[model samples]
Target: MASAADNPLGTYLRDRRTRLDPAAFGFGGGRRRTPGLRREEVASRANISATWYTWLEQGRGGAPSADVLDRIAKGLMLTEPEREHLYMLGLGRPPEARYRPVDGISPRLQRVLDGMTLSPAIIKTAMWDVVGWNRAATLLLTDYATLPPDGRNILRLMFGNAQARARNADWDSVARFVVAAFRADMTRAGGSAAAAGLVAELSALSPDFDRLWRDNDVVAHNEGVKRLHHPVAGPLAMEFATFTVEGRPDLGMIVYNPATSADAERLHRLLAAAPDG
Candidate 1:
């Protein structure tokens, strides 16, 4: 645990507490010298004693449980990053990740994806749902924009789409790797139970998926070579890597760069030949 002199957890708590609009939370016990809710009011919201909260602010309280910190975080209405920061200050590590469904990426993040004109890039949730992609990805990889909302999942495409399976140069290896990595990602995100329905659905739909899931192999999706035989472009070899989206443990971005200059040229020509371009 970080000491008060260095970590300043108390100072952070006081700052956040004082910055809040007391009236917004239905707190109205007359105005005082300072702003935000009083210590007792905050304690009441957090369901802890006023003395304990005061001691926490004074750095005299002992290390608090994750439950206590979570309550305090909710009471303060902390944002995700703010809650994580609180965990880091109160504890030595971050809190366990809570999986949140990501509807889409930000405009700024979409701009980052769009900027990858040559490199095929995609932003996916921990559950392998393709939430965002660029033109290159659509041309060289799967056309995510045209797919139905449920059809955007990579695993479903891998196991359920015949065209998708046909595109893989080494189908068996890639399929196995995808299954293992998917398992690892969901487990790390603490969403294994949440994904049980998908697992069961795919298991029944594809025998290959059933076999792979039964293997119980877990692997990390870091960097690897991916070969996809695009119908228009023929065999395409790309070096693919997964990256964690900053401050979002539930999201990742994958960028696939052409493996060789020839492949790059082929991609460039393919992009140029697209009717949409």
Candidate 2:
């Protein structure tokens, strides 16, 4: 039998396995004795040997590394909190924050966005995909609804789309800022496969993105001043700040405030003229 300290990890793993719904992963239409995934199934999904996984479950295997734990977490489709708990139990420490792509937003949060009538606000995943936005955001930025789902990624639009590139007054500086911030995000995510894939795709798509990514710069998305040539309004100056969404640390919100009264009036006029979608 394993010691008290060692046994909890195994017990936790067992509990997670039992709670996981098999059908969610396309393992449906099967009759089984147990409620959740079998040891072999989890091992297969995690790309580890069945015997090794069994050993870990039996508490005979030595402490798993962080990388191994991460793989298991992904394999099990563990939520961020669950992944953190797994790391604490398995490795005696919490894992670092990672980029998580989330689309779900509570109605209360949407109401908060809606209430910010004067500010252009948008909620984005760690990868900078625009998942939610207020009316002011749609007016200030491109109408997200008009773009393809995948095209809503901020970095992709900034670098890959001609319209976005043309809208920015200082494209080079903004591009650098985006690349640097994304690099830092990737580091926090432990260079996840999703991050790697996005990098690879962007590098191939835009020469500027490729070059900036290779420059190896890193930055935090805190606050910044922006100057843009709005197609209708023209020469809009704004100040923007980013905040982590409450209860969802992996998601971020950017709120753009008008720097001058003139800009505020311009936004109001633009919003008034724009059709509600």
Name the top lDDT candidate.
1
**Model 1 per-residue lDDT at 28:** 80
**Local distance difference test, each candidate:** 0.89, 0.85
Task: Kindly state the number of residue pairs that clash in model 1.
Answer: 0
Clashing pairs in 1: none
- Candidate 1 structure lDDT: 0.89
What lDDT tens digits, residue by residue, belong to model 2 across residues 182-254? 7876687567788788899999999999999999999998999888899998899999999987546667899
lDDT of 2: 0.85
| Model 1 residue 62 lDDT score | 84
- Model 2, C-alpha of 237: deviation from truth (Å): 1.1
- The stretch of ten residues in a row with the least summed lDDT in candidate 1 is 1-10
How does candidate 2 fare on TM-score? Answer: 0.68
- Superposing every Cα of model 2 onto the true structure, what RMSD results? 5.5
Write down the TM-score for model 1. Answer: 0.91
| C-alpha lDDT of residue 244 in model 1 | 85
